[model samples]
Target: MEVKNKVIWITGASSGIGKSLALLAGQKGARLILSGRNTARLIEVQNALPNPECAHILPMDLGDIESLQECVRQALGFFDGIDILVNNAGISQRSLIADTHMEVYERLIQVNYLGTVALSKALLPHFTEAQSGHFVVVTSLMGKFGSPWRSGYCGAKHALHGFFDVLRMEHQKDNIAVTLVCPGFVNTDVARNALTGDGSAQTRQDQATARGMDPGRFAQKMLRAIEKRKMEVYIGGKEVSGVYMKRFFPRLLHKLVLRSKVV
Candidate 1:
């Protein structure tokens, strides 16, 4: 809903889409709790906000699911409780399944899927007690359609859709909302930091990702979707068409994905 005066907790707030969201939310007068593993970068983002005083930094590692509840407690203590929790912290994969190590998959799942789940569960009690809260998930277009070199990434994102859909259904009575924001290819370092077969960062940007929508613009669209409490929203360029293709013409989408130079 309206962001003004609302307490919003955003993960991955150091850079990329999360940073963009923090900036935009700050402009909208929302009190923010910014979370990420990079303390310096988080502080940098906070300082860049229009109202840095209204923002709190909470450095956290989403991969560490066991510590998430404690993180949640700290976040709640920041401003009594968070009115919205944005699940935006995640890692990506850039290798074929056959070539990827099991640890790579585990890493992706731990950060992208289980991490989101753990944090959401930790915050669920608060949301239920208040009976008013929003969970905004930043997933991917690949969550809906399979891709060339993002098997583990796709799996993790797809799992988010499943879990959040059920969460929305089960929590409807509590007036808690779930919004899944599926971004196709955003212009960010996600590809550069993507995990490879050996679990090392890809350290290279993808052509398509480099040419994707600007994170600032994407965040604006994302906030609009959250305001409307949409169940799912897709943000990107032509790659967004892939989601619809998968819905009505899976075979065509499959063929197109096979022919496209994803990385």
Candidate 2:
């Protein structure tokens, strides 16, 4: 809860929300382990922090499932123990299921869903043994609703909700906390990097995403949720309303989604 002096491991720490969180966490006096595929960029982020020495960059590809256990081992060893694990490394889909190849869906599942699961499972034993650890998962609003042009992304995020929800229930007695963070459209490179029909990046930002919440503001709200140890928190602008709409008025939300030009 108290970020100061806490050992937090943040995946996808090179840029965007993860980078923001890392800087904020560093300012708050948290010892950080920043991980991402871009080693140089991760080091850049570490250097930008308030106390560069307080953060360590651990480059890793979450999609590489075989190496995740070893990654977790290295993560734990960095600070002797990890107080929080932020599952933020993920890719997004920007094409319709009909246009998308099977490989696209598989890649999304492998990187976004399975990678998160593998890392969490690898760290579960340590958390159970400590009986005091937090798993903060950065899912998406798409995880709560199926929208156009994001079938694979939505499915993978939805799967994360199910997994973390169950993890919360199973680990409650163990004193392990699970927090699912569902972020709506945020101003980030996510859209530009979103997977297309052929599993290639979209290379262009969507209008809505470009106008979405600022990554720094989103990160601030995210840290608040983590501090409160909330079961789940949705952070965004008007798009966040969609979560409530889907909850109490699914039919209405469905109609709106069908008519709205999300892209």
Candidate 3:
């Protein structure tokens, strides 16, 4: 679908891929509702938009699931109806599974999986009534092929595939589209904001992430997928082939994954 003049709500819009998408959508003449955890950073993004008047800032924390409905309501009050909802707000993980605490897993699921589902459910009725809406989910390649030191993050992203797969089938009659986007490591602040076992943000970015694709380029690719209304899209460097490897050679792929440079 053409994005121009469409009202889109993108979470995690303060920086990285979300920020890039918001600015690109603005240039495409789309009205935007940009959300993120940091109010100051979100406002900074809004300030940089070429069409700032078309972008609305909404500071949100998926952890606060209970209040998300109110947040959605406030966002909706500004526009007629959202043409697309980009479920991009999520936390990353780093640490061996054995070393990870139960609390860490709980927080990861709460933010990455449960919160995303809750917000989608809350918005379901509106989409059903309108009979025209799209859900663009930004899960990781980890969701398809797991790597080391991110047990909880992998699990949460994996869950989204199952849940959204079912949702796509169930809601097809309603004209509600679900596009699951699985991205490989892209150069972004995600690594810096990843949570450690102790629930603190990791201060340093990973080496691989620092050298990953530019956020602007990634966003351009993603917009094409959205425009094509693709059911799923896997994006990344050659490592992205690991997904196909797993499908064709599970046992051998498992061994290869065990020795992956990502670890």
Candidate 4:
């Protein structure tokens, strides 16, 4: 569907892929609600948009699950209705499972998986009433294949796939669509901001992430997938191949991941 005049609510809109998506969608004439934890940065993104007046900033902390229903209420009030909800607000992990604290795992699951699920659930009735809506989820390649030092991250992402798939199946009659966008690796602060064993930000970029696909380019492809209402789409460079390899050649993928030393 064309984004022109559509009301799109994007979480994690302060930077990275979410920021890029906001810019592109704004240029395409879509009304936007930009949500993230950083109110200042969200404002920066809004001003950067081609049509700042078409955008509204809704600061949110995804881990604050109890407030999501109220957040959704406020979001729907922005445009009277929302055509798409992009579940892109999430955190990353970069520590070995053994070394990672239990708090780190809880934070990962809360922010990356349960947060998205709660926000979506809160907005379900709106979609059902309208009989038309789209849920775009930004998971990761790790969701489909395992890699070292990201056990918790992988688990959270994998759970997104399972939950959203069932959401799609159950809501088909309601005409609500779900699109799972699995990104391999995109040039972003994901690595630098990733949580360590003690639940602290790593604050250092990894070489692979530093050399990943451009965020703008990735956002363009993602928007195309959303417009087509694809059930699932993988974006990024050659790392995307791992998804297929894991499906057909699990042993080979396993060996390659082990050799990569992904820390």
Candidate 1 local lDDT, 56-108, one digit each (tens):
99999999989999999999998998999999999988998899999999999
After superposition, the stretches of candidate 2 with alpha carbons farther than 4 Å from their true spots are none
Assess candidate 2 and give its TM-score to the true structure: 0.99
lDDT head-to-head 2 vs 3, winner: 2
| lDDT for residue 216 in candidate 1, whole number 0-100 | 97
lDDT of 4 at 47: 96
Residue 62 C-alpha lDDT in model 1: 96
lDDT (0 to 1) per candidate: 0.94, 0.94, 0.90, 0.95
The whole-model C-alpha lDDT of candidate 4 against the native structure comes to 0.95
Each prediction's number of clashing residue pairs: 0, 0, 0, 0
Worst 10 residues of 2 by lDDT: 90-99
lDDT of 3 by residue, 4-109 (tens): 9999999999999999988888889889999989999999988888889888888889989998998878888779789899999999988888778899999999
lDDT, residue 45, model 1:
95
Residues 1-263, model 4: lDDT tens digits: 89999999999999999999999999999999999999999999999998899999999999999999999999999989999999998999899878999999999999999999999999999999999999999999988988999999999999999999999999999999999999988999999999999999999998899989999999999999999999999998888999999889999999998888475
Please give the TM-score that candidate 3 achieves against the real structure: 0.98
Model 1 RMSD in Å is 0.6
Off by over 4 Å in 3: none
**Model 4 stretches astray by more than 4 angstroms:** none
Measured with C-alpha atoms, the lDDT of residue 180 in candidate 1 is 98
lDDT comparing candidate 1 with the true structure? 0.94
